[model samples]
Target: MTRRRSLALRLIVYLAIAQMGGMLLLVPITDFLISASGMAPGWEVAPDDWGEHRIYGLVAGSVTRAETGEAILEPSAALGAYLETNPQARYAAFDCSGVVLRGSSRELVDALGGLDRIRATTLKFKIPGDPDPRARGFLRRAPAASGACAIAAYSYRFAWDDLFAVAALFLTPHSAAVVAPAVLCALAIAWIVVRRGLAPLRSAAADVAAIDVNTLHRRIDVEEAPKEIAPFVEAVNDALTRLNAGMAAQRRFTANAAHELRTPIAIMRAHADNPDDAVFRRDMKRDIRRVQTIVEQLLATARFSMRDACADVDMDLGEAVLAMVADYTPLVIESGRRIEFEPPSEPTIVRADRWALECVVANLLDNALRAEPEGGVIEVRALSTAVVEVVDHGAGVPLAERDKIFEPFWRRDNKSNGTGLGLAISKTLAEQMGGSIGVDATSGGGATFRIGLRKSVVAPPIASFGRVEPQRAEGSVGARRGTA
Candidate 1:
C-alpha cells in the first residue's frame, strides 16, 4: 500500500508554497514600479555653447544645427559623450526636428533599429538573443526654451534572468534548511495537539475492548470524550445497554422454563414408577426417566450458561465420579449393561462446584451406558487427580463428529431416547468450573470421554459407603440395592 502523507505536512507544504508564490509575484511588481519611476523624467545635459545658441535638442544619430537643420555635433560623438557619463543607461537620446542625438551605446541603438524606428510613444518589445529577451521604452515630445521641438526617449530592458535568479534563491537547499525546520516544528505541534485531542477516544476504545458478556454493565464515559465523538460513544453505550437487557431476558426465560417443567416431570416419574402392570410400569418408567434426563440436562445447560453461575467451592473428583457411577450403575445393569468404577485410593480434590462436577460425571456415564450394547462394559476411572475418564465398549464417536457432539441439540444418530443436550451441558459445566471435557476413541472399539478439572491443593475427607452388586432374575437384570 502506498503510504499517505501526514495532514500537517501537507498543510505546511501548501501554505509555504502559497507564501513563496506571493513573494515571487511581488518581485516583478517591485521591479516594474522602480523602472516606471526612474524613467519618468528623462536624462538631461547642457553644453557651454547652449546658453546663447538657443539649442533646442538633438535627435539620436542625427547631426543638425538647432532649428536650422545645420550639422553641429555628429550623433556618434554626442552619444559617446552621454554614454561616457552614464554607461549603464539603456537608452538616452534628444531629438530636434528630423535629426536625433543617440547615446554612445551603438549596440543598443542598432538593436532598437536606430532612432528612426523608435515610436513617439511608450512601447515594450522582445530583444533578439540566443534564447529570449525583452525591454520597455517611453518617448515624449517637449518644448525647449527656444520654442523648438525637443524629444527625449528612454528604454529600460527587462531583467528576466535576474528576476528568475532571485526567485530561485528561495527554492535552494539553504532555503529548505530554513523552511524545513519551521514546517517540521509546525507539524510536531499539530501532531501533539491532535494526539492530545484524541486521548479520550483511545481511552474509550480501551473500554470498549474490555467489554464482554460479564462486563456488560460497564459503559463508555461520554462526558470525558471529545465533543465530536461523544455522540458515537453514547450510541455505543446505548447499544450495550440494550444488549444487556436482552441477555437478561434470555437468562430469565431459560430459568423460568426449567423451573416450570421440573414439578410436572417429577410427578410423571413418580406415577410411572408405581404403575400396577409390570410391563406397562417398566416401559412408562423408561420413557419417564428419559423425560427426567432431558429436563435435568436442560436445567444444567441453563445453569452453566450463566456468566456468574460459577460456585467457588472445592470438590473431590474421585467422590464425585464414584457417586455418579453408583447412581447410574443400577440403571445400566437393568438395561443389560455393566458399570465398573476405578476411583483413586486417595481423595482427588479439585476446585469446582460439587453439583456441576456431579452433573458432568453423570452426563458422561449416562452417555456411555446409552452407547454400550447389551452386556457391554462401562468403565469409570479417575485417570489422574484432576482428570476423570469414562470408557465404554460401544461404537466409538466418529472423528469428524467428535466436536459436534458437545454442541447442544446435536445428535449423531438422532436417537429418540437421548436429548442430545447431555454432552453439551457437561461441557458447559466443565467450562464454568475452569475445566475442559473432550471425547476420544477407545483402544478397543468404543469411545473414551475425558474431563479435566483444576486440581486443588487441599485434600477432601473420606467417607465409608457400601458397594452394590447387580442381581439377575429369570435372565433379566435387576436393580442393585446398596446397604449401609
Candidate 2:
C-alpha cells in the first residue's frame, strides 16, 4: 500500500508541476511580447488625447521643458499625473528635483509611504502635461542649464506594462496559497478510491485466515470467496476427497483382517477340547497347523501392502515352484499322496521379489496338498516365462467358489481347516511382485493353480534339481512315491 501510494502521489505531483509550471512561464513571455509589440500607447500620453480612463493619464497644466536639460514642473500637476496612472501600481511620487508632492496630492503619496518619511530615492522626469499621472512621476530636473539644451529631466510614471508585470509576479507566490489546499483535497480523494479498489483482497485474506484442519470438511463458498481464489478452493476440495478415500480403504483392510483371524482361533480351540480320542487328536493337530498357515498368510498379505513390487529381483520360476513342492514332502507322505515336479527344458527366469515368490508358491502348494484325496497325485509344472502350475487330483473347485476362495475368511468345504486367506494372500503377493494368480485347466482332472511372473531370458543349469530330485523308479528299493 505504501508503494502504491507513493506512485500515485508522484503522478499527481508531476502533473500538477507540469500544469502549474506551464501557466507561470506564460506570464513573462506574454509580458515581453506585449511590451515589444507596442500594442497600446503607455499611460504617459497628453490628458486630452488619452481621455478619462480613471487609473491612467498624465498630469494637466504645470510643465516646461528647460532650455538647458532641466524639466521645470508644477508640483501638483506632476504628482497627480503620477498617482492617476498607477492605481494598481504601488509607488512613492517625488518632484522634478526629488522633492515630495505634498498637501493636496498628499493622500496619494501618503498611501504609498509619505514623502517626508522617504530617506532614499532614485530620480526621473515627470511630464505634468501628459494625461497619465503615472507617467508624470518620471519628471525630473537637470541640476544646471545651458543654452539650447538637448536633454530633459522628468518623473517616471508607472506604465500599464509595468503594472501588469508587477501583478503577474505577485500572483505567482500568492496563487500557491490558493492552489495548495485544492491539491491536498484532490490527493485525499485519490487515496479513498485506491482503498476501495483493494477491499476485495482484504476480504479474501480474512476468509483464508479463518480456515483450519478441523474445518476441512467445510468448503469455501463461491459467494464468500473472491473469484481469483476459486481454483485454490477447488484444489483443496480435491485433496480432501482423496484423503477420505484413503481412510476408507484403511478401515476396510482392518475389518477384513480381523474377520479372517477369528475362524483359525475357533478351530484350534475346538480341537483342544476333544482330548480323549488319540487319532482325532492327531487330525486336530494337522488342522491346527493349517490354521496357523492361514494366519501366517494373512500377516504376509498385510506386510505386502506396506511396500511396492519394485523390490523384486530376477529369479528362476521353475526352481521356486519345485522348492515349495519339496517342502511339503511330509504333508504329501502323511496324506498318502504322490507328488511330481516338472519344469521347462530351460530355466524360466522371472523378475520378482524372491521372498514374495516363495510365499506365493508355498500358499498354492498348501492349498493343493490340503485338497488332494488319499493316494491322489499332485503335479507341479513350470511353463514358459515364470508361469507355474500346481495341479491336484481331487474334486475341482466349483465355478462359483473359485473367486470366493481368494476372499478372506471364506471356505469352500466345512471339513477344511483353511482360514481362507491363503489364496487371497497368494494373489496379493503375486500382484505386488508384478505377476498374477489364476486358475487353469488340470492336465486331465482336478484343480490347477496358475501363477505368472515377469519373464527373463537367462536359463538355469540344464540338469539342475531346482528343489526336487527325481525319485527312485517306482517299486524299486527305498523308492518314494511320485506323480507327474
Best of the candidates, lDDT: 1
Model 2, 149-264: lDDT tens per residue? Answer: 11122333324444444445536667877667766676577667655655655665565577565454555455654576567666766776666655554565567546655765
lDDT values for all models: 0.63, 0.58
Models 1 onward score TM values of 0.43, 0.45
**Per-residue C-alpha lDDT of model 1 across residues 205-302, encoded as one tens digit per residue:** 99999999999999999888878999999999999999998687557546645654565567666766777755765666676676677678666656
RMSD, model 1, all Cα superposed? 20.5
| Segments of candidate 2 deviating more than 4 angstroms | 1-276, 308-310, 397-420, 457-459, 462-484
Candidate 1 regions with alpha-carbon error over 4 angstroms: 1-277, 459-484
> Model 1 Cα displacement at 393 (Å)?
1.6
